[model samples]
Target chain A: MNLLLSSFSSLTNKVLMALAGLFLVTFLGVHLGINLLLLNNDGGRAFTAAASFMGTNSIIKVFEIVLFAGFLLHIILGMMVSGQNKAARPSTYVVSNHSATAPFSKYMFHTGIIVFLFLLLHFFDFYFIKIGLVAPPDGIASHDFYSRTLLLFSTPWYSLLYIVCFVALGIHLNHAIQSAFQTLGLNHSKYMDAVKVIGSVYSLLITVGFSIVPLFILFYRH
Target chain B: MNFTLKIWRQKNAVAKGEMVTYAVSEISPDSSFFEMLDALNQQLITSGGDPVAFDHDCREGICGTCSLYINGRPHGPLKGVTTCQLHMRSFKDGDTIHIEPWRAKAFPIIRDLIVDRSALDKIIQAGGYVSVHTGGVPDANTIPVPHEKAESAMDAAACIGCGACVAACSNAAAMLFVGAKVSHLALLPQGKVEAAKRVQKMVACMDELGFGNCSNTYACEAECPKGISVVNIARMNRQFLAANLLSEREKVVNISL
Candidate 1:
């Protein structure tokens, strides 16, 4: 109701970025758990049930709106933060040293862009198909999200792209997990080490968990 | 010690600047960094050359005026110490040291190795203090502050406003400096009343003045001469969030029977 809600500050922008980022982080876990159902030998039976529930559930439908809003806000705020950061230093140092900083921290924008591109391609491959804007592959039910995912992963190029994007996702999450906490003001001296450790474990889980599925489909599913 | 110095030299704030090399030999290892620079200045004056202009006051490290970006690190290759406190003994004989000014759009160069850090003062002016009436000091024990919060506030109060945090940060963010000021005052009973408004105004001023957002690089904390912890940055963020979210009073509705 005040100017604070309408206006922006550096901290406000960062808080938005962190909240949206953590929300997306939670979504990644849910997504990875659902996608892991692909590994079952029941020909996508469990995966289809879960996927249909996700697609049709009312609560999830509301969450989908929230999720897209989060993504949009995160992206817009990210771009503004990056732009302001760039403007803060118009001239580059002839010799800059970033040895003290985390190696992955420097490439956040690069990895984020890669992830964005991957998300777009992923949407085209699956989401666009579900909305009926694109035709489904032969012998696949229009609602058979599992067969389509399997077929997409079956392609060598598609699988390679997925793996590459997953690696980028891992790198992004590695810095982002702990960074989100620090941004959200959850950092403390006593628990800092634990936060970092948990962040790394979560990042690894997301990366390895999602990545193995594509490799499994590409190499062993036939 | 004999050392080759690559020093940035500029005639004025708007002039083009470049790194000029000078060799100084027979320097005492016991000489502080600023003393060595003084020796160099004497040699330059004697040689009829323009002496390098840098900022320094209270060579004992209390004043945050000695601003030097040395060897890609702020305040030379030391942690928890300012440029004035660094000694020549830290560098080996015949070593080459690079010195530059703290560079940022907000902190423009005033001269060689000197940047005008008034942008920090501006941020402080925005809301870095609590408004108070002119009156006698309150009894220290009257407001009982927990030992931990007092110690925490003191830790944050140690910030010297040296601008090293901005220079060390890859994005030239001033979050550490602003965080220190905000956190220090926010923790004290005298400062709690205005804490919400203070954080909001200070943060907005920081963004408006062209300081970047912190990405949690920890560089600011690493190169901070005062060793101000990023914990203060987190604390400032918490204050900001609380202010942004909870400071407003919502309107109450009256239902008719």
Candidate 2:
């Protein structure tokens, strides 16, 4: 534990966050693919089946637990890192003639707060509602995932909110992916171009794809 | 153009500091930020008031001497630009600009807007030098470096020991600055002789100086006047990790075997 604390305590939060973020990135790919099912004219069992499979699989259950821990750890470490940073430089620049120092996503403890709030509402409206814990108001088909998403997506304001959060996710991912590689020491110029390209593409897709659902649902009733 | 300035004035290290407001009238927009400060100083001199003492030299932006916390940013609003490079045009007709020095516990205020950045010097003293001591100037081409590596090394070497990286950094971490220094020397063949020990000493010095950890923020890169890459930070980390693992293993082998 002393060895662990000595070496890992300082950067442990960042390491955990990078790993968890990568996990969520993979999860995003799968989740988005499943959500894309709702785009179908003849909405098949793909959405429900994928959801059901993810819901029941023992391995997935374990993964979910890790995922939850990852999210919490990420937040906890992020907060710690941010707090230390704040204490390190107690005074802000007076007439800051300088450009931004940290990447927007890099210095985003405050932005993460916004994202965390959005995630809470998202989990409650979708996951919690489906899991039977959330006692949705009468007349709302909270359990029907498709109907639930459609309902939220149908409203312009709700769709706008999703768009806003998705934009934040883009901001978050743009910084995190490259940073994760940096933390892991994969920042050589030889492969850095490829990493940067992949990071940008991945961030763009998550930002554009996630927001598209709400826009599509809002414009075209399904 | 007339401008109002809110400058941070600290009497000494022990004294608490605050922003003191001063207005400058009839200023040319073409004047550099420091030049403008000089003009303000001239005005103060005429009025028998204390001149605002800030650190600056080689006003050409190479020496990295000018340290000012200009309006909530390190060098002022221009991205990838330095205070010396900053012109009055960036300001409006009547702008209320706040100016302060780099604030950190290690960088205690010496006077108004000037703190002792010798902590940086000490870190450099610890390991920035090569183990190979020079007797005299040798044939330059003897230590051959690839054009790309040489250029990159020079670019990293461009770090003027400016605490801008620390000032710009929200974490106030000297990773980019230190990384640039470490990489500048580490990348070259001449400095490679001491590479194993160089990293360990520099990192130790950095920690001893009371700077924060990097936290993977690239703000230092963005704000670096020399455009030092945050990738240098990664290079530094890899070097440190390698030194710790391989050299320490060799040490344990000697003890046990």
Candidate 3:
């Protein structure tokens, strides 16, 4: 409707971006749950089975489309919002602003860019193989994600990059979960502390949970 | 206390500004920050130099007129106080203090440390009011308000519109100022009459004024002289969402009709 379109402003853009980000957050949890199956001690039999199910499921296929859409929308709107925010101050201050805000809050865009670059590397290692854009390494099937993940994490530099990216992802999500709630108008004084606590906990879980897999592969799996 | 001041100096709104250094000696630690500046101005006038221009009124914190980004902090190093109330005692002797105006596209420099904050006034003019008819004063307690709601409304009403929030924000956003105003009214029964329309119009005006979006950095809450909470911003966002999505509108008639 014209009335609806007329009301779409910066706030609306933020709300949409927050919704997309929250969607990606949920996807991260689901992905981590699936990835943790790599530690099943059955030589990745369980992990590969689950990865195949996720790759072939009809509903998940549709969700894959939505997931990519969410990522693109979140990235595009984030760029737009950051651009406008940068333009709001035409000149730099002689002295740096020293407000006692959370240190990571201002660097959301920076952390987000790091996470995005990591996502590209991750897709090249895994998703691109699944979609056949990149060929799987010799003797590994395209559906054998567990082997591919183990192969990637087995390299010291690759594991280091994975851990570093997970750290950046953690920092990004630390502010992001609560920020998304605030942007969506779901925040309140009564529960805002709880939201912040939950955000920190979730970010920690994702960072530790994912990083543990790489360490486990590199150290114990060998 | 002897101190060197690195103050922003500009001839007028259109002129380029720079950090102009000056030395002030024998300032009493008991003197307020503005008084120390007054002494510097006196010395400058005697020497036939232009006095640094800054905004101040009421000498106390209530007027919300005084503004300065001293040492990278709005209203100097103290928390929950304005520049007018900040004393020279907060700084050490021989310290060089940096002072500048609020930096934002919506707030242009008027002189040296004085910025034109009329963009805030424009936001207020958009819908930051109730459309009450002029009449005899209504009796108290005529429309009952819950105690908690009234308390919350008063807390939000403490915003001084000093533009410190805008200065403190990385994005130069005015959400805190506008949020405080919107929440201050939206919580009360008198303001409830036009709450939906008020939020919509005010937000439209804010976006058009070239102020940035709130990224939830919370620097506004930290640097606000009144210690206005970011909860008010959340309340504003809630009001804005409800207004745009749920508020029913009257049917529009064609001009010919």
Best by lDDT: 3
lDDT per residue for candidate 3 within B1-257, as digits (tens), equals: 99999999999989999999999999999999999999999999999999999999999899999999999999989899999999999999999999999999999999999999999999999999989963566687777889999999999999999999999999999999999999999999889989999998999999999999999999999999998988898889999999988999869988973
The residue-by-residue lDDT of candidate 1 on A41-148, one tens digit each, is: 898889999999999999999999999988878877777778888888876565686437864887788899898999888887888888888888889877888878
Give the per-residue Cα lDDT of candidate 3 at A118. 92
Off by over 4 Å in 1: A1-7, A137-142, B133-140, B248-257
Compare the candidates by TM-score and give the number of the best one. 3
For candidate 1, the per-residue lDDT at B59 reads 93
What DockQ do you compute for every candidate structure?
0.58, 0.38, 0.79
Give the higher-lDDT candidate: 1 or 2.
1
The positional error of residue B75 in candidate 1, measured at the CA in angstroms, is 1.1
TM-score each candidate: 0.92, 0.81, 0.96
Pairs of residues clashing in candidate 3: none
lDDT of 2 by residue, A128-191 (tens): 8877789765677665676677777777888898899888888888777887888766798789
TM-score of chain B of 2: 0.92
Estimate the TM-score for candidate 2. Answer: 0.81
Best by DockQ: 3
